[model samples]
Target: MAKAYWIATYRSIADPDALAAYAKVSGPAIAAAGGRVLVRGTPAQVYEAGLNERTVVIEFDSVDAARAAHDSEAYQHALSLLGEGAVRDIRIVEGAEG
Candidate 1:
């Protein structure tokens, strides 16, 4: 099966402290679920129509694994800590076979 990627792009951050708190918990939760963070940060440069937003990409063994990680109790608690802290767009996509 193709690897899966969890991509999250933060459109806006209203509370940096809240985001930090969520990250503190979510990081461990994701690691426990077998996710490898591939990239995380604001883009170095923006192309046409691309906003300078914070983006994170995490790799998982498969789509099901990624979904499970997102739905896990630990992640849910992290989400609660991040409530209304920021606006983000998240997606899970299967990687192309080499």
Candidate 2:
């Protein structure tokens, strides 16, 4: 099965506390579901036309695994913090075989 990759680009974080809240909820959720965070932070440089200021990348075993993680109760619990705090864009893509 192809691996699943999550790429998120975001900006305008008005409340760092919201990120803190997500860290508390989503960190354990990702760990519990075997997801790994490949990268999380500002990029050294972004050349894309619509690129956001911050970026995050995550990897899961397969598309199903990624879907499961997104649909999980724990992640939903984490999402409660998103409103009014920041704007985000998330994408899921299939990775190539090694």
lDDT of each: 0.98, 0.83
- Residue pairs clashing in model 2 are none
- CA lDDT for candidate 2: 0.83
The candidate that achieves the highest TM-score relative to the unseen native structure: 1
Local error of candidate 1 at 86, Å? 0.6
The residue-by-residue lDDT of candidate 1 on 22-69, one tens digit each, is 999999999999999999999999999999999999999999999999
Name the regions of candidate 2 deviating beyond 4 angstroms.
48-52
What shift in Å separates residue 21 of candidate 1 from its native position after superposition? 0.4
TM-score of each: 0.98, 0.89
* lDDT of candidate 2 over 19-62, digit per residue (tens): 78887888789778878999998878768585547888889998
Which stretches of model 1 miss by more than 4 angstroms?
none
**Candidate 1: global Cα-lDDT?**
0.98
